[model samples]
Target: MSRKTGTLLCLIAGSMMLIIGCSKSSEDRLTTPIPPSDCDTVNMTYSSDVQPILEANCYSCHGNGNVNGGVTLDSYTGVKLVADNGLLIGVITHAPGYPPMPDGGGKLSDCDINKIKDWINRGASNN
Candidate 1:
């Protein structure tokens, strides 16, 4: 092809590619990105945050009137006992000489642990 025609074709091809790259389809734009974690540990409350974690992980053995190891967590009073003694944090954090909690299960999630710590640092109230 003539030099001018060849140059025109190259420009057209580049322009088409630019348009295609810029004008992505709705489906392409609608990418299902893995959203960041919604692990909100702000304003952690015993009733809302701490109690739920205990009920799910500790209640089976330490709650509902079971009181295994004399460690009760089903009620605010029982929980306060451990919280005051630092046993709560020690066991949950798997500290040396302190048994890991949830019996043989893995450690609690970072978010759950953070929520508990926040509540305790806020005085571990009945709220």
Candidate 2:
């Protein structure tokens, strides 16, 4: 074959190989069912169970009086206020009219969300 024809054939073969290699990988996709929340055993008033979850997930904006949606989850009373008003449960559960918590992205795990729900169901006490 002439030099120009040989180079053209090689370019076509390289482009085909590139296309096949770029196809999506089956293993990278998610295909499992997510479990529902388990809130029956969570205690809202206990600092051990509740504080860390709040500090890590909520404090960034809820702290220092920078409450985002007219609600605060900083102290016991603040958390209780939202809980008593049913806003906490509504947002965490992503009910139709309310947006999910942490507004930026990923939601709290089902377990954590359930714990908050359980706390609210139990009257959202400060104790």
Which candidate number maximizes lDDT? 1
Worst 10 residues of 1 by lDDT: 27-36
lDDT of each structure?
0.90, 0.72
User: Residue 50 of model 2: what lDDT?
Assistant: 62
Please report how far candidate 1 places residue 89 from its true position, in Å.
0.8
- For model 1 the TM-score comes to 0.71
* TM-score, every prediction: 0.71, 0.62
- Report lDDT (Cα) of residue 90, candidate 1: 92
Q: Give the candidate number with the greatest TM-score.
A: 1
Per-residue lDDT tens digits for candidate 2, residues 1-127, read 9999999999999998877666444333444444554444556554656656777887887876778877677788787777777787787677888978777767887777767777667776666
Q: List where candidate 1 sits over 4 angstroms from the true fold.
A: 1-36
Clashing pairs in 2: none
Model 1 Cα lDDT, one tens digit per residue, 1-127: 8999999999999999988887776557678675448888888999888999999999999988798888999999999999989999999999898889978999998788888988999898889
> After aligning candidate 2 to the native by TM-score, how far in Å is the CA of 76 from where it should be?
1.0
